[model samples]
Target: MTAPEPAEPPAAEPGVTAAEPAAAGPDSAARPGAEPAEPTDADAASHSAALPGADLDGADLDGADLDGADLDGAEPAGALPTERAAAGVPGKRGRRRVAPAPEPAPVLDDAELRGALEAILLVVDEPVSELTLAQVLEQPAERIGPALDRIAAGYTAAGHGFELRRAAGGWRLYTRPEYATYVERFVLDGQSVRLTQAALETLAVIAYKQPVTRSRISAIRGVNCDGVIRTLVSRGLVEECGTEADSGAFLYRTTTLFLEKLGLNSVADLPPLAPFLPDDVEELADATR
Candidate 1:
C-alpha cells in the first residue's frame, strides 16, 4: 500500500491575490482598510461613569461635561459651622466664647474692717468665731486676729463696762469683773438664786471635759445626768457644740456665761483638777488638760 499523495492545495479563486490572507470579518484586527475606531465623548463618559476612580490617561474628556455627574459620595471642602463646633475644630468661628467668672470683693481697710466687725458683734447674742468674723468682714483670719486684739486692748484701756473676751472657742463681750458685784445685786435683787449641787457638778464636768456627750457625763458622775444637763443648758451654762465622731451623740461645752460667773477668762484658767482628784486618778487629769 502506497501513501496517498498530500491533498492538493486549495486553488486560489480568480481576482484574489494568493499572498494575501482571507478577508477578515468587521470585528477582526487584520481586516484591510480597517483603522481602530476612535472612542466618542459619549462612549468615554459612559466608561468613566461605569468604573469609579478609573484611569483615563488616553481618554478624551473635553466634551465629557461633568456638570450633571453624581458626586454624592465625594467629601466637601469644608464642614458646616454646627458640624465644626461639634467636632471641636480649632480656629473655627463656631466655637463658643465663655465669659470669665466674677472676682471676689476687695478687702476693706483696717479701720473699715474693724467697724464692720464691731457692728456684727453688737447684734450677735452668742460668741462669734474668728472664722465667722473673717467671712463677714471679707478678710483673712490672720488679719482678723490682730484687729480683734486691737479692739480688745482699746476696750480695756478705755475701761469700758464690757470687755471683749475669748471663750468657748469664740470672742464675746462680758461685763467687767469689777462690775460683776453690781450686776449680780441688780439681777438677783435679794432672791436666793443658785445652781443645785447636781447642776454645779454637771457644769464642772462639762467645763473640764468639753465636747462630752450626755452618756459619757452620766458614766463619769455614776448617775444619769440628763436632767442636770438640761438645767445647765436652760441656765445658759452649757451649750451643744456638735456630734461626736464615734458615738454620733450630741456633745456639750461651757458657755461665756459660765466663764463670767466663775471669774475665769478661759477654760485654761481653771484650777488644776489633779489637786481635787484622788491620788490614783490624778494621772487622768493630764489627759483632760
Candidate 2:
C-alpha cells in the first residue's frame, strides 16, 4: 500500500500528442505567417518580359526615370533616341544621316570679276600671269582669262592712256605705242645729252653682242671696259642679265628703256653694222654676235 504504483503519468492534453515533429509536406513550408519562397526561373523570366525594355540585351537603365513610359506594351525607355540613331550612333535602327557637302564657292559675275582684276592689275609692277591672278581672285583660270579680256576691251574702248598687253610671258600695263613720242619728249625735256666716246663704243658692243661679259667686251675692244660699262649702266642703258655659262662672269644686256630711247621695238630692230665697219670687220662682228 505504501509503495503503491506511482500515479500513472499525467495524460497529455486532449489535443496534444507526444513531443514529436509533424510530418513535412509541400504546404508545410508555406504556412500563412511564413516567408514567401524565392521565384523560379520561369516565373522570373515572365515577370521581366512584362517590364519595359527587358528584351533589349545589354541595355542600361540604372539612371533612368521611366515613370512617364507607357506600361502596356510600349517601346523601351532604354533605347537610343531617334536623333542619335539617325546620326550613325550605334543601334535603335534608323537611316544614317550624312552632312551635306560644303557648297562650292560662288562664282563672281563678269562685271564684278573684271573690276577686281582691274584693281589688282593697277598696283602690280611686274607682269602678272593669268594663273597668279586666278589664285589671288579665287576664280577659275578659265574665268580669269575671259575677265582679263573684258577688262582689256573696256580699257581700250575708254581710250585709257595705259593698255594691258601680254609681255615677258605675262600680262602687264604698258603705255600705248601711239603715246611714245609724247612720253619721250616729256622724258628728254628738249635736252640733247650725249654719251662719251668710250661709253658709246661700249654701248654699241653691248647692243650687238648682247648678254656679253665685261671680260669678253675687254677682249674684243683690246681695252678694259669696266669703267665705260659702269657709266652705261648708271645711264640706264644696260643691265646685268645673268652669268655666262662658260666664264661664270656677269652678262650684260640692253634694257627696255634703252629701246624706248632708241625708238626701237626690240633689240632685233638695230641697224646692220655692215656700213659702219670695214668689210672684214663687219663680217667678223656679225659672226661674233
Candidate 3:
C-alpha cells in the first residue's frame, strides 16, 4: 500500500483577502506574507507570536493559553468582565434599580396549626384560654373561639383520655371521669376532696349564671341556697357582693380559683351553653307568673 500525501491548504474566498502574518510568532517563518517587527525590545531581543484580538479590553488569559505566542499586549480571556452600565448613553441618567429579596408565601397549613395548638396546650400547666391563644397566634378572639371548639370536638371524637374543659376563664386539659383514679394519683397528694350534690348543684348554677343575686338563685333552683352559698364561700369558689339593685338581695359570683379549677383564665373562655330555662310550657308559664 502507498502512504497518503498531506493535503494542501484551501484557497481563500474570492472577495476576501488573506491577512499579513503577525511578526511575533515562530510561524512567521512559515507564513507567505509576514510583517516586519517594529524597532522595540520585543523586536530586538525576543521572538514571540502575536495573537489577533488579544488586545480587547477586559480580556483574560490566565484561564486560557496563547501557546507561546505574544501575550504581553493581551488583556487575558480570564479577566473579569465589566458590568455594563444601564445606557442613557453614558452620564445622561439611567433607571433607578433595586434588588428584591424572594418573598415567602402566606398560608396556614392545617397540620402546622394543629401542631402549634397542641404545643401551646402541652406547655400550659392549666387550661389555655382562647383570648390568650388568640393573642399568641395573632388572630382574632372570635377566630380562636371556633378553633378551640374544633380541637375540643376532635379530642372527644378520637376518644382521647384527656378532655378539654373551660373553668376559671381559661381552657384546661382534664382526665375523663373513668380515668380519674389515675389522674387523682398525680393530682391529689393522698386523698380526694369529695363534693356534695348540693355543693355541686350550687357550684354549677353559680358557674353558669355568675354575678347573680342569692334570691334569683333561690328562685331558679326553688330552694334556699344560703347554706350552699356559705359552703361555696368557705371553699373559696364563690364570693359575695352588695345587693342587686333590682331585688336588694346579696349578689354572688364565682372566683378566680373557680377559673383555676375549670382551667380558664376568664369567663369568656367557657364553652357556649344551651338555654338554662326549663323547656316545658308549664314551667315557663309558672316562671312567668
Candidate 4:
C-alpha cells in the first residue's frame, strides 16, 4: 500500500560500523584526583595553590581565558599570587575597580583665588552676583561669596580706590566714596580718558543694542555712524571682534572703559535710558546740540 516501502534503507557496509563515540578513558573523564578540566571554585583554588611564584593579592585575573582547562578548577591563568599576598597582606576581594581619588578636590591657591576675583570685578560692569560668578568659574556660590569678601578687604587695606562691592544682584568694583570727587576730576582732565558725545552715543547704542551690527546702528541713528565708530575704535571704546553668521555682517560692542567713564561696573549698571521715538527725535537733536 505504501509506495513500495522505499527500498529497504541501505544496509551498512561490512565492518564499516557507525562511528561509536570514542570511549572516554579514565584519564579523559573527570576524576576526583584530576584537576577539573572545567573551572570550578574548588578547582580554581587548587590550581591557584599550585601556581609557582604567583602572587594572588594585587594580582587579578578574573575573566581570564583558560581554554577549557580548569587547572584544578582554578581559572586558567588565574590571578597569580602577588608578593604582598604571599606575605599575608590583605587583598581586595570581589571589589570592582574605582576611579582614582578624584584629583585631590582641586584646592585653589591664594593667588589664583585673588586673581580670579579681581578678573571677575574687572570684566563685570555691574556687581557680579555670587551665583553668576560661581557659574562662570564652576564653583560653589557659597565659597565664591566668601572669597569675594576677602578680596574686597585686601583691596581696601592696600588703599585701592576700587573695591569689590555687592549690589543689584552682583559684585562689582567701585571707587571708595572718599575718592569720588578726586577720581572724577582726574577722569575729566585726563587727556587719555576724555569722553565725547559720539563715543557716548555709540556706547549707548552698544550697551542698549548689544551684539548689534553696524547697519542696525546706522539705521537706528538715522545717520552714518562710520566716522563716530572710527573715532570710538581709535579711542579703544569699541571693537569689532567677530562677524555675524547671518549675512557675514560685522558686529560691534562697547569696551571696558565705557563702564569706567560712567563710574559703572557693568552694563547692568547703566541707567535705563528713555526710549527714543519719532516725536523724541527733536529732543535727541536738541540734546546733542
Which is the leading candidate under TM-score? 1
lDDT of 2 by residue, 1-289 (tens): 4877768888767654343223466555444543344566766687889898757456577997765454443344565667455544533232335669999767888778877888888888766789998888778998887777777787899999988766544576778889978987998999877788888888989999998999989988889999999889988889999898887899999987677556465688789987787758768777877
In model 4, the number of clashes is 20
Which candidate leads the pack in lDDT? 1
How displaced is residue 190 in candidate 2, in Å?
7.7
User: Tens digits of per-residue lDDT for model 3 on 70-133?
Assistant: 4333443444323223321221123234448877534445666666777788878765678788
The lDDT for every candidate, in the order shown, is: 0.80, 0.76, 0.70, 0.69
TM-score of each: 0.51, 0.46, 0.41, 0.43
User: Which residue pairs in model 2 clash with each other?
Assistant: none
- What would the per-residue lDDT of candidate 4 be over residues 39-152, giving only the tens digit for each residue? 557656878789897768565578866454424423223455564345443334422244377553465676886787787678765555788776776666678877888888
Stretches off by above 4 angstroms in model 1 are 1-93, 185-193, 209-230, 233-269, 275-289
Candidate closer to the true structure by TM-score (higher is better), 1 or 3: 1
Q: What tens digits encode model 1's per-residue C-alpha lDDT throughout 1-289?
A: 9998999999868765444333457775544853454566867688878988887868687887666454543334577756644665533233344648999879899889889878887887877789998887677889888898999999999989998878656777788889989999999999977888998888888989998999989978889999999999988889999999987999999988887666566889999987787886757756655
Residue 177 deviation, candidate 4, in Å? 4.6
Better of 1 and 4 by lDDT: 1
Between candidates 2 and 3, name the one with more favorable TM-score. Answer: 2
Minimal lDDT window, size 10, model 4: 89-98
TM-score for candidate 3: 0.41
What's the TM for model 1? 0.51
